[model samples]
Target: MALKLYNTLTRRKEEFRPVNPPQVKFYVCGPTVYDYIHLGNARVFIVFDVIRRYLQHRGYRVMLVQNYTDIDDKMIQRAAEQGFTVPELAERFIDAYEADVRALKVKPADIQPRATGHIPQIIALIGRLVEKRAAYPSGGDVYFDTAGYENYGALSHQKREELLAGARVDPGEKKRNPLDFVLWKQKKPGEPAWDSPWGAGRPGWHIECSAMAMHYLSETIDLHAGGADLIFPHHENEIAQSTAATGSPFARYWLHAGYLNIDDAKMSKSLGNVLTVRELVKEHHPLDLRFLILSAHYRSPLNFNSELVEASRSGRQRLQEMVDNLNRALPGAGAASAAAESRLQAALEQARFRFTEAMDDDFNTAGAVAVLFELGRDCNIYLKEGYPYQRGLLEKAIGFYREANKILDILEMENPGELEHDIREAIARREKARCRKDWTEADRIRDALLARGVILEDTPYGTRWKKKA
Candidate 1:
C-alpha cells in the first residue's frame, strides 16, 4: 500500500506524493526563540522528526526546513526585560532549543533559517504583495488586504463572513478589514527595526514564516507542519500572504500535531504548570517523553501528568529489557533452526507490516508503538519456550528491534563491554550457581542484580540480564 498522510488543508488522508518524485521539500514552523521551548513545542518537533525519518526510510530524500522567528514582539519585550541585545537573546534561546530538542532525538532540519537573516527575502516578498495590490502601506506600516484574497480563511475552514464577524482591529491599528494582518510593522522606539520600503520596521510574525519557508524550499512545497494552535492566525495568514504573492499553492500538505495539556488544564505561565524540556529531562528520560507523546495519535490532545510519564518510563524500560534479553541469548545459541528461523522471520515481517500500515495511515504513531510491543512479545516467547538456540533467529529479532528503533528512537542500550567488571563478575557468579543447582546462591545473586536495577530472566539457552528503568 502507498504511504498516506492526513492533510489539514484537504481535511482528509491522501496518498503522499512529493512535488518532485523521490524528493520532499518539507517546512515546519520553529519556535519564536524568545525563551526555553516547552513541552507543547516538543510534540510538534518530535512528530515531524519521526515523519521525516519514516519518509527517509521509505527512500525519499527529504529536505526539511524549519524556520526560527528570531525577531518578534515577544523577543523584543523579553530581551529588554533581560537587559540583552535582541540578537543576543535570540541566539541564546535558539541554542537552547537545539540542545533540548536534540535530547529528544529530533534531528536538525536541513535548513534552519532565522527571520532576521533573510531580510532581503522578506522585503522582496512583501514588495511583490504590495505591487500586486494584495497589501497596502499606511503610515509606514504594511498590512495584507484580506479582501484581496478570495479564499482568505480557506485553510482554517472559516467563512470570510464569520471571520469578519469575530475579528476586531486592535487599538492603534489601521487596516481596511478586521481580518487584515500585518505584513510589516512600523518602528517603535527601543524596538529592533530594519529598513524596508514602507519604513524602518521589522517583519510581522506571519510574514517571517512565508519569507523563510519560500526562500529555503520554494513558493510551492510538499509539506508544511506545526502545532494545531498555529492553524488560525499564524498558518492562515501565511497562506494568504504567500499564495497571494506567488499565485501558487503555498504547501500541498499541511500537518499539525495536537496540544500538550498539563493535568487537563491548558499549559500556561499564570497556572505555573508550563513544563520545559530542560526541566522535564532532569527527572524523566527524554525517550520517556517521546514515548508518551507517541502514545496518542498526533492529532489528538495529550494530557501531561506524572502518572502518564511514569507509564511511558515503564513501557520504555520493558522494550529495553526485551532487547537486552534477546541480545544476551545470542552468545550461547547454536546453529540456525529452520523452524525457529521461519517463525521469527514471519513474526518480524508481520510486525513490520503492521508498523508500516499504522504509519501510512496518517502517521499513526500510537498504532506504530503497539507494533513495537507486539514484536517484543514475539521475541520474548521465542526466547523462553520456542528456542533450540537458533542464532539466526535471535539475530533477526535483534535486527527488527534496531530497525524499529530508527523511527521510535526510544531504545538506547549500554554496550555490554562497557559493563563494569563487578557487574560482569556477578553475571558469571549467577551462572556458576545455576550450574551447581544452588538455588539459594542463584536467588541471592539475582536479588543483588535487582538492587542495581538489573533484571535476570532464565531462557531455554541460558539466563540473560537487563537493566531496569
Candidate 2:
C-alpha cells in the first residue's frame, strides 16, 4: 500500500505524492531559541523525526530543513534580561535544543537555517511582496496587506470577515487592517537591528520562516509541518506572504501534530506544570519519553503525567527484553528443523505486513506499537516449545524488531558478545539454576545482578539480562 498522510490543509488523509519522484522536500518550524525546549516542543520534534525516518526507510531521498527564529521579540527580551546580546542567547538555547533532541535520538535536520543568517533572503522576499503590492510600507515598517490576497484565510479555514471581527490592532502598530501582519519591523532602542529595505530592523517572526524555507527548499515544497498551535497566524501568514509573492503553492501538504497536555491541562509556565526534556531525562530514559509521545496518534492530544511516563518506561523495557531474549537464544543453540524454520519466517513476514499497514494509514504509530507487542508474544510462544533454537528464526525476528525500531526508537539492543565475561557468566549460571529448579540460587543471582545495574527477565525459553537505562 502507498503511504498516506493527513493534510491539515484539506483535513483528510491523502496518498503522499512527491512533486519530484523519489525526492521529498520536508520543512518543519523549529524553535524560537529563547529558552530550553519544553515537552510540547519536544513532541513535535520527535513526531517529525519519526516521519522523516519512515520516509527515508521507504526509499525516498528526504531533505529536511528546520529553521531557528533567532531574532524575535522573545529572544531580544530574554537577552536583555540575561545581559547578553540576542545572538548569544539564541546560541545558548539552540545548543540546548539540539542536546535535548539528540538524547531522544532525533536526527539533525539536513539544513538548520537561523533567521539571522538569512537576512538578505528575508529582505529580498519582502521586497518582492512590496513590489507586487501584496505588502505596503508604513512609518518605516512593512506589513502584509491581508486584504490584497484573495486566499489570505484559506489555509486556516477562516473567512476574512470572521478573522477581522476578532482581530484588533496592537498598540504602536501602523497598518491598514488589524488582520494584516508585519513583514518588517522598524528598529527600536535596545534591540537587534539589521540593514534592510524597510529600515535597520530585523525580520518579523512569520516572514523569517517563509524566507528560509524558500531559500533552502523551493517556492512549492512537498511537506510543511509543525505543532497544531501554529496553524493560525504563524502558518497562515506564511501561506499568504509566500504564495502571494511567488504565485505558487507554499507547501503541497500541511501536517500538524496535536497538542501535548500535562495532567489534562495545557502546558504553561503560569500553571507551573511545564516539563522540559532536560529535566525529564534526568529521571527516566529518553526512549521512554519517545515511546510515550508515540503512544498516541500524532493528530490526537497526548496526556502526560508521572504515571504515564512510568508506564511508558515499562512498555519500552518490555520490547527491549524481547530483543535481548532473541539475541541470547541464538547463541550456542542448535538449528530448528526446516518446517519449524519456515513457520518462523512466515510469522516474521506477517508482523512486518501489519506494521507497514498501520504506518501507511496516516502514520498511525500507536497501531504500529500494538503490532510489536503481538510479535513479542509470538516469539515467546515459539521459544517455550523446548525445541532447539533456530539461529535464522531469531535473527529474522531481530531484523524485524530493528526495522520497526528505526521509526519507533523504543529498543536499545547491544551485542551480547561485547558484554563483560563475568556478567555473561552470571547470566549463564542463573539460566542453569532455573533449569535445575534451584529457585533460591536463581533468585539470589538475579538480585545480585540487579544491584549491579543489570536487569534480568525470565521468559519460558530462558533468562535474558540487560543494563538498566
Candidate 3:
C-alpha cells in the first residue's frame, strides 16, 4: 500500500505522494526558543521524529526542515528579563531543547533554520506578498491583509468571520481586517532588530516559518507538522501568507500531535503543574517516558502521572529481561520445532502489518506500540518454550524479534562486547561492595545504577542489566 497521510488542510486521508517522488520535503514548526521546552513541545517533536524515522525506514530520502522562531515576543521578553543578548539567550535555550529532545531520541532535522539567520529569505517573501497585493507596509511595519487571501481560514477549517469574532487583531495596529496577522513588526527599543525595506524590524512569528520553509524546501512541502494547538491561528496564518505569496499549495499534509496533560490538568504555571524533562528524568527513565508517550495515539490527549510512568517502566522491563534470557541462549537457536517457525512467521507478519497499518492511519503510535508488545510476547514464548536449545531456532526468534522492533523504530540492542564489558564492570563494583561488608555502600552502588535507569537482576550464575533510557 502507498504511504497515506491525513491532511488537515483537506480533512481527509490521502495517499502520500511527494511532489518529487521518493523524496519527502518535510517541515515541522520548531520551538520559539525562549524557554525550556515542556511536554507539549516534546510530544510534537517526538511525533514528527518517529514519522521521519519511519519514512527513512521505508526508504524515502527525507529532507526535513524544522525552524527556530528565535526573534519573537517571547524571546524579546525573556532577553529583557534575563539581562542577556537575544542571540545568547536563544542559543542557550536551543541547546537545552536539543539535549532534551535527543534524550527522547528525536533526530535532528536536515535543515534547522533560525529566523534571525534567514533575514534575506524572510525579506524576499514579505516583498513578494507586498507585490502580490496580499500584504502591505504600514507605519514601518508590514501586515498580511487577511481579507486579500480568499482562503484565509482554510487550514483551520474556520471562516474568517468566525475567527475574527472571538480573536482580536493587534489593538494598536492599523488592520484592514481583524483576521489579518502581522508579517513584520517594527522594532521596539531593547528588542532584536533587522534592517528591512519597511524599517528596522524583525520577521513576525507566522511569516518566519512560511519564509524559512519555502527557502529550505523551495516549494510546497510534502508534510507540515506541529502541535494540535497550532491548528488554529498559527498554522492558519502560515497557509494564508505562503499561499498568497507563492500561489501554490503550502503543504500537502499537516499532522499535529495532541496535547499532553499532567495529573488531570494542563501543564501550565497558571494551573500550578509542570513537568520538566530534567526533573522527570531524575526520577523516571527516559525510555519509560517515551514508552508512556507511545502508549497513546499521537492525535489523542495523554494524561501523564507517576503511576503511568511506572507501568511503562515495568512493561519495558519485561521485554528487557526476555531479551537478556534470549541472548544467553543464542548459540543454540537452531533446534526449533516446526511450530516455532510457523508461530514466529505469523506473529511477525501480524505485528509488521499492524504497525504499518497504524502508521498509514494517521500515524497511530499507540496502536503500533500495542503490536510491538504482541511481538515481544510471541518472541519470548517461542524462544523460551517453542524451541529446543538449537542455534538456528534461537537466531530465528531473535531475528523475528529484531525485525518487529525495527518497524517500531525501537533500538533493541547494542554491541554484545560493549554490553558485556559494562555489565561486568557494574557487577564487579557491586560485588566488591558486598564483599567489604559495606552494606550501605553496596546499596549505594545498586541505587546509583538505578538512578542511571539501569535496572538490575542478580541471578545465581551472574547479573543482567538494562538501561532504562
Cα-based TM-score, every candidate: 0.94, 0.94, 0.87
> For model 2, what is the C-alpha lDDT against the true structure?
0.89
Q: Where in model 2 is the C-alpha error above 4 Å?
A: 335-337, 340-343, 416-419, 422-446, 456-464
Q: How close is candidate 1 to the true structure, as a TM-score?
A: 0.94
**Sorted by lDDT, highest first, which candidate order results?**
2, 1, 3
Name the better of 1 and 3 by lDDT.
1
TM-score of 2: 0.94
Clashes of 2: 0
lDDT of 2 by residue, 1-469 (tens): 8999999898889999999979999999999999999899999999999999999988999999999889988898899999989899988999999999999988999999999999999999999999999999999899999999898788789999999889976897799989998899999987779888777888999999999989999999999999999999999999999999999999999999999999999999899998999899998889899999998999999999989999998887877777877777778567655765455577788999999999989989999999999888888776776357777678788889988998888778665555578988988988889889999998999999889888887755556567776
User: What do the candidate models score in CA lDDT, each in turn?
Assistant: 0.89, 0.89, 0.80
> Could you tell me how far off, in angstroms, the CA of residue 110 lies in candidate 3 after the best superposition?
0.7
Q: Global lDDT for candidate 1?
A: 0.89
Poorest lDDT segment (10 consecutive residues) of candidate 3: 409-418
After TM-score superposition, the amount by which residue 333's alpha carbon in candidate 3 deviates from its true location, in angstroms, is 3.4
Q: Give residue 130's error in model 1 in angstroms.
A: 0.7
After TM-score superposition, what is the CA distance of residue 379 in candidate 2 from its true location, in Å? 0.8
